[model samples]
Target: MTVLLIALGAALGAPLRYLTDRAVQARHGSPFPWGTLTVNVAGSLLLGGLLAAPVDPAVTALVGTGFCGALTTWSTLSYETLRLARTGKRRLAYANAALSVAAGLGAAFLGYALVTALTG
Candidate 1:
């Protein structure tokens, strides 16, 4: 049952992430990869919230491991950064790498803090 729930959550997360990335990229119209950045930060925030919540293990597995694991993609971010560097967008590549890591962490921390405030 846990496995099935995880799978179901991942199924929903993956396509949702894809569509979000596409939409954000379409709006941005640049190689900056705003789409991936958005998803990564958002996913981190969600996972952080779930971790702090008093939810069941199955719920954590589904939302944290399955959904967030698929939704937040380090691989894609790395690939995009590399592709940018390879294509001579060294400045943008560096900015993307730095900003994504920093902002993602901040977002996660904020989510955890929010949960703490509410639950405490």
Candidate 2:
């Protein structure tokens, strides 16, 4: 049952990630991989909320391990940053790294606070 739930969640998360990537790419083009950044931030917020909520283990596995895990692509972010550096966009690459780390952390904290307040 746990495996099944995780599989289902991963299936959903992967496609959602793809759609988000494409959407951001469509709007911003493939210069900096804004989509990956956006998705990672969003996934951080979602995972934070899930962690804050009093959810069961199975639900946690599904949403946090499977869904958010698949939805957030650190690999892609690394690749894109490397690509930027390789193409001589050193400043943009650094900015992307710094922004991703900082904003992802901030969003997660915000989500946690929101969930905590709601639950309290």
Candidate 3:
């Protein structure tokens, strides 16, 4: 049961992530990989909100473990950063790492706070 729910969530999440990455990359011209950053932060924010809310374990498993896991690609982020450095965009690579960490944290915190306030 749990596995099925998680799988279902991942099925939706993976494609959504791909589409979002495509759209963002197309809009930004693919220099800084705004797509990866956008998805990571968005996934973090969504996970934070879902966790903070009074939801069941199955809900957490499906959305947090599966959806967010599928939606956010740490491997891609690392690879893109490496590619940027290898291609001589070292500054952009560093910036990507820094921004991903900082913005991911900020979005999670903000999401948690917002959900808590709204629920309260």
Query: Per-residue lDDT for 2-110 in model 3, tens only?
Result: 9998998899899999999999999986589999999999999998798789999999989998899999999999999999999999999999999999999899998
- Candidate 2 Cα lDDT to native: 0.92
- 21-66 in candidate 1: lDDT tens per residue? 9999999868899999999999999987887899999999899988
Q: Which stretches of candidate 1 lie over 4 Å from their true place?
A: none
Whole-structure CA lDDT of model 1: 0.93
lDDT, residue 1, model 1: 93
Provide TM-scores for the models. Answer: 0.97, 0.96, 0.97
Task: Please report, in order, the local distance difference test score of every candidate based on alpha carbons.
Answer: 0.93, 0.92, 0.93
RMSD of every prediction: 0.7, 1.0, 0.8
Candidate 2 structure quality by residue, lDDT tens digits, 41-91? 999999889879999999998999889989999999999999999999999
Per model, how many backbone clashes are there? Answer: 0, 0, 0
Error of 1 at 36 (Å): 0.3
Candidate 1 vs candidate 2, TM-score winner: 1
Better of 2 and 3 by TM-score: 3
Output the worst ten-in-a-row residue range by lDDT, candidate 3.
22-31
